[model samples]
Target: MRRLMMTMLFLSFAVGAAACGGGAKTTGADAEGKIKITTTIGMIADITEQVGGEHVKVTALMKPGVDPHLYKASQGDVRKLEEAELILYGGLHLEGKMTDIFENMAKQKTTVAVTRDIPESQLLLVDDGSGTHDPHVWFDVKLWTRATETVQEALSKHDAAHAAEYKQNADAYIAKLRELDQYAARQIASIPEGQRVLVTAHDAFGYFGKAYGIKVMGLQGISTASEYGSKDVSTLRDYLVANKIKAVFVESSVPKKSIEAVIQGAAKQGHEVKIGGELFSDAMGPAGTPEGTYIGMVRHNVDTIVKALK
Candidate 1:
């Protein structure tokens, strides 16, 4: 449905923009001697910057607290995409509105999906029975290591002069990611075995739970757009009651209403569920904050969950 809408607007928007065109001004590395990379999500942009180091400049389309599931490409964003020397995005329709544009760009641009480096077998199938793989691979640090590999290879391929530097940066970044995974394991294990359940606004953490041994429950389905019926709320409320769960989390990019509703429903049935600290699900934190970085976001989430649930 989103692709269909983008298709209708693509030709008109492209033509109009070209007719009245003065492109975005280049700066920093793009002005100097570095590759200019544009990405759809902060996680992708963060990895690109880390792996490419001083050899690349990255511009991310979606900002903090922006929901990528419903994000549309603005004219400025499209111009950035057109001007970039390379493009990186999460695949599996994570950027639902921009999928078609990315597909059309492959012929003329160096567009890469970071998630493509991971084998399809390792990705989780959405519970919607849609036959589509979940796009939140970054939640699992080990899986995210695959994404950094693609980032490094793309940077090296585009700038052969800096290939060795890119590889070195990638190696260092991968080591940090492994350490992050171990930290998450130790923190997650701190929660009592009887209270090892996580409830959140949506199913963005399926991979996180599977990777960390926490049982995750979301009030809504994989995509936030998936409708939840009265029965869905009641079923989760029952789960909370049966398991003696105490906290449900809200996502930075998603609405808290659904999770709040679960909290209310749980309260009605004698289980008082508190709002766990916000988790950076579809997006990262602000630019300067610790949660803004991928590793920092993971650490914050682990610490938050453990403090609240343990």
Candidate 2:
């Protein structure tokens, strides 16, 4: 039914755009000569701004603390998508509800998935028999560098005049991400190996664990759209008691109630588990905050995890 609603919304917007002569379509830049780019999530927006530098004016459709798994596009979002000279999004069903909208928009404008260039072998399967790969690629900074490159290449191809600047900025941004990847590795290593278990409200941090040599367990599945029951809570509680895991983290975009329940459950089992810290999972922090940027967000997550689990 939600998918139906999204489809209907897209159809209505498509008709409106057609009626308005393709919504006065414009490309390459606005009056300020800045490439008008629209990205689906804050992470992509940050990367676009970082790589495009002064040559792009980027707008993120989703704000901080938004869960992209169930995000639906509003008519206003359609307008933004229509107005953008170029559109970038995290693919692999990250923006699950908005996939059709993006697919249709790609037919009308330059739309690219930042994760398009990532090698499939590096992506983890959901293990749900759906053949779906995990969409939280940013948790692994090295993989996210490919996303940065995709953004650079997309911007360069769309606005060839600033190709050189885009390349330079992207290279610099990638270098910083490499440093962040190293930092995450070093920090995660500090946690006692046996206690290197990261529990969260959801399985969004699988890639983070894979990258940093931690065991990640979440009460919920890869997508928060998947429901969790009391049985799930009890199961997680059992694991915490069995492994003597000290802390579990809550996600900014997910409800704390789930983790709070896990904490209570662990307490009943005579194993106390505290919320290590709130990690940025599906979303980053507020616009001007340090955690708002991708690099800052990763650092905050790594530091939070190390402090909690060490």
Candidate 3:
């Protein structure tokens, strides 16, 4: 019922955007000569802005702490999408509910997925047997470099006059991402191998674990939309007690109660599991803060994990 309602709502928004006067379809740029780019997640928006420099204006539909897996585009979001000359989204079902909307918008304007260019060999398959890979590629900084390149490629294709500038900007951004990847690897390596387990609210850290060589366990599955029950908690509790795991982490987008419940369950079993710190899984921190940026968010997570488990 919820999916059906959201789909209907999306259709209405699409119709309304077309019917509204003076909301004429935006071409390459606005009257100010800046390409209007709309992105689904802040991470993509930040990269677009960095690559676009002064030639493009970017707005993100999903804000900090927003869980993109369950996010449905609002009416205002539809208007933004309609007005955008180029739209960039995290693909592979990251924005699960808005897939149809993005598809419809693509037929009208330039819509691209940052993950479209990422190789399938690098993508981790979701164990759900759906034949779909995990969408949390951003967790691996090196893999995220491809997303930056994708943004650059899209911008270059849309506005060829600024292609050189886009390439220059993307090159600089990729350098920083490479450094961050190295830092994460070095820091995570400092933790004793036996104590390198990372338990979190969900399985969003699969890429992070794979990239940095840490064991990751989650109370819930890849998508938070998946339900969790008492069995899940009890099983995690036993795992924590048996392994003598010391800390778990909460997520910025997911409710803390689930992790809290796990803590309580561990306590009853005579095992203590402290929350290492909040990790930016599906979403980054608030705007204007360091954590709001992709590099800062990854650094914060790396530092937090190293502090707790090392």
lDDT of each: 0.90, 0.92, 0.93
TM-score, cand. 3: 0.91
Which 10 residues in a row give candidate 3 its minimum summed lDDT?
Answer: 20-29
lDDT of 3 by residue, 204-243 (tens): 9999999999999999999999999999999999999999
Model 1 misplaced regions, further than 4 Å = 1-29
Scanning candidate 1 in windows of ten residues, the lowest lDDT window is 22-31
lDDT of candidate 2? 0.92
TM-score of 2: 0.91
Off by over 4 Å in 3: 1-28
Query: Predictions ranked by TM-score, top down?
Result: 3, 2, 1
Candidate 2 residue-pair clash tally: 0
Worst 10 residues of 2 by lDDT: 22-31
TM-score of each: 0.91, 0.91, 0.91
User: By TM-score, is 1 or 3 better?
Assistant: 3
**Between which residue pairs do clashes occur in model 1?**
none
Query: Candidate 3 clashing pairs?
Result: none
RMSD of 1: 8.5
Measured over all alpha carbons after superposition, the RMSD of each candidate to the real structure, in angstroms, is 8.5, 8.3, 8.2
Which numbered prediction scores highest in lDDT against the true structure? 3
